[model samples]
Target: ARAYRMEWPADMTVFEIDQPQVIEFKATTLAGLGAAPRAELCTVPIDLRQDWPKALLDAGLDRNRPIAWIAEGLFGYLPPAAQDRLLDNVTALSAHGSRLACEAVPDMSQVDHDQAREMMRRVTAKWREHGFDFEFADLGYEGERADVASYLDNLGWRTVGKPMSRLLADNGLAAIPQSNDSVSVADTVYYSATLSK
Candidate 1:
């Protein structure tokens, strides 16, 4: 995907990558590679899986340094087991002062397969036509209590959570239409967190 970037002065370092997921990683890697004006760009293979966190650790992602990891719009696409495994992997690999943020989608355990499939049927059908219909399991922390946070805490990281309402309000979005009318609506609520080991 092509994106237009605001140009910076020639002396400023810049990094660009073709994929949305790698943008920050590439930018950080670029800045780390040089003290002078420079840019580094690379495409991570899609076949790369959750092991990336461990790989980054092995590659010496600085634990003493604050790093940002994002799993945007990704949680629901993974099975519950995979979700847990990935988070566990990340927790094990992250260093002190590392911040990880993500939108905690509804865990599949909270969703009925029939309802979820029906609700997402159209998109799934479209993707299947294109030869890729990703199977999904919504999985994350259990509640406002932040299960993910507790899990991370056991791994020696301090944790904080940001709720979805606050995020929407920050971005000037009004309450979703018809959202407040039902207590039973599967909370698509997102829980975000920061952790420092």
Candidate 2:
């Protein structure tokens, strides 16, 4: 949606997909603001757990055209199997030159699950004090999950993984200080890859 607000070339079309409630909220808010999107924007309201490809196609997505797909802040919320399924669908729909960028969680094998859960509990409690009541631990699937970059590599995609610290520095930003509550910040990696096959 933010991309659509920017005045890009007319040939480019931006599509935003999300759950029905989120789509509804965005639509309503835009309507209330009377701010129209600058470029062609399509919003597809479909659950990720369901057939999203069909929904996207119905919304006028061109499967033959190359696309830049972003999966930021999403994979951790889904189980490992679901993540694989989503990638499979994406690979099937993507054209030869399509690109994919994602933020992936670090390997959890070395971390203590109990300690992680406790940390999340404290974070959740802090959020609850401000009005949001939700279990942060329950929101994510924590276990031995496939390394996203490796999975993409095996699927014939050329992958490049950048650690969060390096990424920040590359953008002329300082890295965050090391702290107990900063494990996630330190562990996250960003990936940018292109389909080669």
Best by lDDT: 2
Q: What residue pairs clash in candidate 2, if any at all?
A: none
Q: What tens digits encode model 2's per-residue C-alpha lDDT throughout 1-197?
A: 67536777878788888999998998888889887887788888899998999999999989998888989989989999899888888898889989999988878888888888998999899999999988999999977889898898888789999999889889999887887753577679999989987
- Residues 31-130, candidate 1: write the lDDT tens digits: 6865323232223323235346544545445545555566666655555556667677766656566667666554355545565555455556677788
Sum up the clashes in candidate 2: 0
Task: Looking at model 2, report the run of 10 residues with the lowest lDDT sum.
Answer: 178-187
Q: After superposition, how far is residue 133 of candidate 1 from its true place, in Å?
A: 8.6
Model 2 alpha-carbon drift over 4 Å, by segment? 4-7
Residue-pair clashes per prediction, in order, are 2, 0
Q: What local distance difference test score does each model get?
A: 0.51, 0.87
Taking every candidate in turn, the Cα RMSD to the unseen true structure, in Å, is 7.7, 1.7
Q: TM-score for model 2?
A: 0.92
